[model samples]
Target: MQQSLKTAGVLAFQRSLYATDAQFYSVLPHQQEKPVWVIRHGIRGTQNVNKATEKEFSNIQITDTAKLDPTAEKMKVVFDIKFFDLANSLFACAKGKKDKEKDTVKKFRATYDAFLTRAKDSHGLKEVVLRYVRNCTNGRWLWRNLTLASTATITVVKNDETEHGLSFDAVALSRKGFTDYTADELALAELFVANLQGYATDRFRVTALLDFGMPGVQVYPSQLYTSNKPKGFARPLYAVGAEEPVRTVEDVMHFQATRKMGQAALRDDKVANAIRTIDTWYPDYESIQRPIAIEPQGVSLELQERFRIKKASAFEIIQKIDELDPDSPNGMFMIASLIRGGVYSGE
Candidate 1:
């Protein structure tokens, strides 16, 4: 794992009219000085909810881990319920086990209880957070990055289809899910690799937009909408592929925590701490978070690329965008799209 507390920090980027990069920067320190290679949680794109009864929550069994597409790169991976249920089962044991110690049981229950309360009562919490994502507004958009500038887009994304190909293979996850998105607003029907009938599968997630620190170039208008927005631009990106299948309650819990903590490790040391907490609280964590396979950013022809224009000097890109998409009645939007998608190959 080339990533570190410092290196992963640099690559962690978030965009929103509501959230600042600094807040994320503060959460995850940028000691490595390289763009962090991260993918958000891609939940199962289904409206159906997996309402587990109390009985199901209490019983959890081990399952197989999801594999990665060996031949694919830049492919969006999805998670399964085997992992989620594994997490929930462990926690249930920690908090509900009659054989556990009082203090240990209390602490575990407290954590789970706190999480449940927030999931069910985030509206009240938002009153205290002022401008937080409060509810799982756009759960699909979670973990997606925006194109702040057009520096490496064309360069990295357009080089070859091989780098973007999707391969289906089993991978080991340490402490996270397919993407860094997790919320209850929508019940994502994911697959359970360990299930008797499923293999490697994820869900479809929506795309998002982002900004680069290019000078004078405005990535978009002052006001933005998801429909007319660029892909990977949304803070909490949506869209996912088909889910594997749900076999148990443990799958849901592990999937949920993994999705929440994918980028979380890079977000802050605290997130790592949270992982430890859950690990201790839940012992049967091996099933959901198998051996993780995240790659670290490196110095390559792609890294050589730089933003042709900077946020401070954004005149060039912006001027070109306006020229092409004149904001006029008949002007087309492809010009801006070209600029937005154009990769800054300049070193």
Candidate 2:
């Protein structure tokens, strides 16, 4: 009889997909002029609700905001993505101490290899890549900004070669779910998969340009948390600029120090989360009818719920990879979780 194997004690995988901070720019319609950098502004207002003992006491609230130039008719968001080799056989590590544990680790490695092979051979990786591409083309990364724009155009250039790029109407694409794709979108998705499979010789750069058709509108950027904040101030939006003298509460807001091209930007992790919001395969997906970000246990912050529990969790599926079908939803989730990368030590 064959001996049962235990989960590996120490297992870790590095993230394969890397995204840079997305910069915001304002451009004039039907003009060839240089795009203007969106600048952050300091605004002051009075707090509506009174948390103090005195009902008449109103506190001043200072915050940061960014808006497009008055003459600008379009808002441009630009970001770069880099793909790394997705072979877990070399990047993922598994360690064991005793004889039985060593055997279990060996078996775990074998199972991972087998599953990876199946994923490559089947439609697993392609499905995941296509969903990611859909999210990018649909302007889902814009978050709140997408709703402000009446229309959007998304252009994706592979390796900075504009001639071999793809463009589409981002607003027409569905944000709630993944569905049909045009020929150009499919081509771009194929390139994404190729880079992930290590078929490309160089680390290809994929640049995403999202042009939103909203004139002189407010644009949203990721907000930075304030610690030991002033008495009356709100969280500040993320920006890149030089450190100026702390003359007021707004001066306490965070900004990246730079002499040139300083502007409000979205964090890399935020952009990555947007791109990886393809977890429609979770248990409650049928009821929710919307995709959440790919998480190990199918956690949705907005819903404040854990959809995948017990046997449905990624950690559980990973231990029994040998029994999983690479084409199934759970299998695809596991593959995506590996790509997201984290320590999965069963200790």
Candidate 3:
């Protein structure tokens, strides 16, 4: 799922769909055998926006030849966790007397007590991986393997009956690292960094919240780049000689081949090996997700299609995605993917 969504179109498609805890968790590979709670999902930002923005520029090595530092990425990202009482939600939706609500609460209390007792016998958690979708289209854009070293300020939100949830805000400084980006992705990164010269950002994108226990969330990242350009990014000599320049994948591939020949001539094995490993993801943007037999559970796909094409207002689409569906799969994802991938009909 992480590598699946890398295209801008796929991301736009993901922006259209919505899902519930049950539907989302059910789709997980290990859910049927061992179900884990999904706590929270959201975004965070660097405390010092200026420093973070500056680091982004330095990471890309876009400065003059004498000023370029190929490994200058360092920043911070903050996280705000919001928790809710699942038992209370279920009890509230239950149709019956007030006593039934009390009974449900008591049963949940007993179950939690037993669970804690069992959990105590297990070993402590060493690291926690907060999984999240950075952008729906570019599934590979993620902060998955994060190793945190920071303290959090926690606030509890309680209700008349029980302790509802807690909010935890933690700030962790970004680590220095190398990230591989495709040529197109690098172009986008260049565009964003160039645009950042005049812009300031205090916060990052927090598209949706996830409750994969402890309320895990995802946030946008900054200042990550690979040391070398992707394999096929070298422009061709013929294109360089031509009056009108063209930057095509074929040209890049040919340039790389020609350069590899030169490297072989000089016996520069290290540079040639690095060049051979140049990775790219241009084909991903053109991929299409085949329509699945998703059972609709929220707003009808027909109405969603209208909203997607601007036949309906943003408010309407928002309301539709926000609708609760505890039983069936929220077809918003299926419909959005199909439409954006050019595989679905409005009807």
Candidate 4:
């Protein structure tokens, strides 16, 4: 009789799809210039709803606001992504209980190897890469910024080679599904698959550009949390700038800056989350009709629900991954989760 597989006590995977923090730039209708800081100002508000008394209604508050440069006609967001070898990206630590350490380790390796072999044989990696490319071309990474743009164009340049790049109509692509693709989108997907599968000499640098046509529209950046927010401020935004003192309300909205460029930016993690929003395999996906970010538990914070309940989570499936069909949705999700990267130790 064959021995049943046991889970590894220390299993970890590194992120295969690495992205850099996206920087913002102000642009004219058809011109490129240095990055500029989004405008920061104050807004006055009055308490109206649920006011306790007449005096409460008169209570006014001041809050900080950030917007794009009023003088510019368009806003440009630029970021880069690097693809890593996903098949051999496991990072295992010490094995399980001493008595079964050797057996557990052996089983773990065999199971993982089988999983990768099946995935590669079935071309599962290509499907995942194509979905990632769909998200990139659709401007889903823009988050709130996507809603503001009347028209948007996304350009994907490999290794900064602008002459050999692909451009897509960001606004035209549907975010609700990933079933349709244009010829250019497929070409981009092929490039990604080639780089990820080690067909390229070196790791490819995928730089993405989002050009929005709205003039002076407000752009959103990753917001920072403060346990004790300054007076008259709603929230703080993530910024890269020189060390300075926070003296006023305007100072709370620190914009990302370099010696020559000042720009609003999104954190790399946020960009990564957007790029991996390809979890349509979740249980609720049929009803939701949209994909959520690939999470270990199939978590969708926006919906405040965990779609993968009970034995459906990546943690549960990974233990018996070798038993799963690599072409199935669940198997594909597990592979994507490994690429997404996280600790999945049984201990």
Q: Work out the TM-score per prediction.
A: 0.17, 0.86, 0.17, 0.87
- Count of residue pairs whose backbone atoms collide, per candidate: 89, 0, 22, 0
Task: Give the better candidate number (1 or 4) by TM-score.
Answer: 4
TM-score of 3: 0.17
**Tens digits of per-residue lDDT for model 3, 1-347:** 11111111111111111111110111123222111121111223334445565444322211100100122111121122121211121112122232323443344335433432332222210000011110211211113212221232222221221243323332221111113323433332332222122232212121112222222222122212345755423221110111323347766655421111110000122111111111111112124221211222222232342212231322222223223121112222222222122211111
Can you tell me which runs of candidate 2 are displaced by over 4 Å?
A: 1-5, 29-42, 50-58, 88-92, 96-100, 201-214, 241-261
Tell me how far the alpha carbon of residue 179 in candidate 3 is from the true structure, in angstroms, after superposition. 33
Stretch of 10 with least lDDT, candidate 2: 201-210
What value does the lDDT take at residue 192 in candidate 1? 18
Q: What CA RMSD would you report for each candidate?
A: 28.5, 4.4, 25.3, 4.3
